[model samples]
Target: MDDSTIRLALERHWAASDAGDFTAEHDIYAEGAVLDYPQSGERIRGRANIRQSRLVQPNTKRFKVRRIIGTGDLWVTEYVLTYDGAPSYTVSIMEFRDGLVVYETQYFADPFVPAPSRADLVERPGTEAP
Candidate 1:
């Protein structure tokens, strides 16, 4: 698939996720897809299993996409995933084959305050720094 096509698919997937539509959310994955969560040391193989893993989660989730960038077979998305109203900054890397995701790995990090020493050098999200 071309970059634009893959980008559209990703947009649809994220939209479905925010809407809690499990079937649509997993549609971008191949039948033998694999999903990895390195922090939790877990790997979910197969589209059904991946969909099932998220299906059981109880938290109300919302996805705010920051950006999606890549070409050909590797794509990366940076987004903020809110669970029960708390935001977790997340990065998802997807490897595709034949226009379907064959492997994906997600990394999540909870928000933290910036160090006091570097306050002058840092700029918060969604703001311009001079």
Candidate 2:
């Protein structure tokens, strides 16, 4: 698939997610597609597994794509995900075949918050700590 087609597919996928329309998002993936999340050391095989593992989440919200880059059949996107109670930035790499996404891998941001420190959590005198 061309760059524009892949971009359009991602756009539709985000739109579907914002509206909680799982079917629309699911349609973008090819049968038996694979998705790997290296940071989590987890690999989800097939559309069904991906849907259950990646797509389904509590209080799911749309992940907005900040930027997209494509070369040949590969598409990469930087996105901000607002799900559950925390928001995070991540990158996704997609491999497309015949206008459908055949493989996808995501990498979440590292150094997540500069790592919380024990001293930073110390309560001051006569003050309640957060």
Winning candidate number (TM-score):
1
Residue pairs in candidate 2 whose N, alpha carbon or C atoms collide under 3 angstroms: none
TM-score each candidate: 0.96, 0.76
Question: What would you estimate as the lDDT of candidate 2?
Answer: 0.79
Colliding pairs, model 1: none
Per-residue accuracy of model 2 over 30-102 as CA lDDT, tens digit each: 9989998898798888887777765556676767778888877888888877776467788989888888889
Q: What is the Cα-based lDDT of residue 101 in candidate 2? A: 84
